[model samples]
Target: MAIELKEYIVAFIDLLGFSAMVQHDCERPKKEHRYIKVLYTIHLKTKELKKTIIGLEITQFSDSVVLAIPYSQENYKKVVDVISNYQYDLLNDGILCRGGASYGKHFSTEDFLFSNGMIDAYKIESTIALTPRVIISKELIDLVYPASELSKNEHLILESDGLYFINYMKNGNADDSWKAICKAIPDELSENPSIRSKHIWLIDYYNHQFPESKRKDNHRFVSPDA
Candidate 1:
C-alpha cells in the first residue's frame, strides 16, 4: 500500500509538571488526593472537545497530546480557535499546557503519528514555548497571513522575541476566565522550581495585560522565586 501524505496543521502539547503532579499525589496521603483527578478530568474533557470539532484528529499519550487538522483557510482558523479554547479550558481548570503549532505534510494512524510537521511542532513546543503558551511557526503564520496582513489580526500576538502565540484572552470574550487564570498562577508557581520557571512568562503576560484595578483584591503577581 502506498503511504498517504497530506498537508496538515499539527499541534504538539505537553501537560506541564505531570510527573511531579503524580508524584505529589502519590507521596500525599490518600485523603489529600487532587492532581490525579484534575488531570484525568482535563484529559476526558479534551477528548470530548476534539471529538466535537470536525476535521480535528487527536492522539494522546501520558502527558503529551498531538492534534492534526486538514489544511485550508477555514480549517486553519478552526484549528487555531480549537487550540485557543482548549488551552483556556485547561487553564481554567488549574492545569497549564505549553505547545507549538506548525504546518506541513504529515500522516498518522491509530498506532502511529509520523510527519515532518509533527517533528517541527515538537521542536517549537520544547524550545520556543518555554512558557505556558503555544508558539506558532513562522511558516504557518506566513501561510495564513502575509507580512502586510499580520498586524490586522488580533487573535495572534507577536512577541518582542519574534515568536507568535495565540492571544486567548483577546477581545474580552474570556475576561473572567483570564482573571481566574491569573489569580491561580501564584499557587501553580508553588508546585516546583521547574513548573514555576515554566510559568514565569504567563505571570508576566498576565501582569502586562491586566491592570491593577482588574486584579483580584487579594491577588498579586508572586515571583516564582517567592
Candidate 2:
C-alpha cells in the first residue's frame, strides 16, 4: 500500500516521574490512586482537543505522547496551542512533562507510525528538553514568519541555551500552578539530588517568568553550600 507522506509539526512529550506514578498505583490504597485519576483526566482532555482541532493526530504509549499536525502556519499554531494548554493543565495537576516539537516528513496510522519528524521530536524531548518544558526546534521557529512576533512572545521563552520553549504560565494564572508545585516539589526534593535540581530549574524558570508574584521567594531553594 502506498503511503501519503507529508511534512508535519510533531510534538513528542513524556510524563516526568511516570514510573513513580505507576509504582504508587500498586502500593497505595484505592481511594488514594492519584496517578490513575490524573491519567484519566489527561486522556479525556487529549480526546476533546483532538476533536476540537482538525488534522491533529496523536499516539500515546506508556509515559509518552506524540501530537502531530500537517505542516502549515495555521496548523503549527494549533499544535502549539494544544501543547501550551496541555502543559499548563498538567502543571496544575502537579504533573510535569518534557517534550520537543519539530517539523519533518511523517506518516502515521492507528497501529503504526513512521516519521523522521517523530525521531526529531523525540530526540529533542530526550536530549534537548533537559527539564519540565516543551522545547520548540529552531527549524520550527524558522517556519513561523514575522520572526519574534509579539503575539507569539506570550507563549515562547528563549533560554540561555538558545532554545525556545512554551511558557506555560505566561498568561498569569500561576497561583494554582504555584500551589501545585509547592505540593509536588517537596517529595522530589527529598529524593535523588539530580531530580531535586531539575525541580529547582523549574522553580527558577517560574520565578524568572513571574517575578512579580510574592510566592517566588518561598519557592526558592538555598544552595547546599549556602
Candidate 3:
C-alpha cells in the first residue's frame, strides 16, 4: 500500500523524569518497582484508546509517545481526552507526562514513518512545554476550533505564555493519583531548584483545576465541593 500525507492533529508526549527514575530504580528491588509493568501499561492504554477513537494513530518509543488524529475539532478533543486520561493513569505510578500538540501533514506505517507534524510537535514539547504539561497553540488553534473549544473544555488552561495546556488533574478526585503525588511531590520538591521548579508548576496546576466556586482564596484551601 502507498503512504499518503494527511493533515492530522499530532501530539508528542514525553515521559518527564523517566530516565532519572530508571536510574534510581536500578538499585531498588525489581519486585518493589515494576518498570516493565509500567511500560506494558502504557502500550495497553494506547491500544485501548485507539480502539475507542478509531482514527487515532499511536507510535511509542522508549519514553516518548506520539498520537496523530484526523484534523477536526472532534478529533482534537479526543486527543486532549487521551492525554488527560493518560496523565491521570500514569500519575498513579508516580510518572509525569509533558508534551506538545499541533496540526500538520503526517504519515506513519508499520515499517516506515516520517512527519513534519511530529517534528513540530516534538519542538513544542522540548521548548515550550517546559513543565509537566502539554501545550498547544498557533497552527492547530487557527486550523481547528481549538481556541473556541477552550470555552467548553474543563481540562484546558491558558497560561500567561498565551499557550493552552491540558489541566490533566481537572477530573482528579483524590483517589490513588493523589496518594501517588502526595508522596512523589514532596520528594521532588525538595530536589535542586531546577528540578523543584517543574514539580512546583504541577502543584500549581493541580490547585487551579477545580471550579472557581468550589475553592477558597488559597491554593491548598478548597471546599469539599472542589
For residues 1-226, write the lDDT of model 3, one tens digit per residue.
7779988889999987778767767878877675667767766886677776888888878789888887877887778888888877777667778899988888888656688888999999998898888888577767666446667867678888888788777656645444656645664245476567777776666556533423222233467898
The segments of candidate 2 whose C-alpha lies over 4 angstroms from its true place after superposition are 146-152, 214-226
RMSD of 3: 5.5
Collision pairs in model 3: none
| lDDT by residue (tens digit), candidate 1, 89-166 | 877777888899998889888897778899999999988888888999999998888788888877788888999898
How high is the CA lDDT of each candidate model?
Answer: 0.80, 0.82, 0.75
Order of candidate numbers by lDDT, starting with the best = 2, 1, 3
Order by TM-score, highest first: 2, 1, 3
Clash counts per candidate, in order, are 0, 0, 0
**Model 2: how far is 61 from its true place, Å?**
0.7
Tell me the lDDT of candidate 1: 0.80
Candidate 1 lowest-lDDT run of ten: 211-220
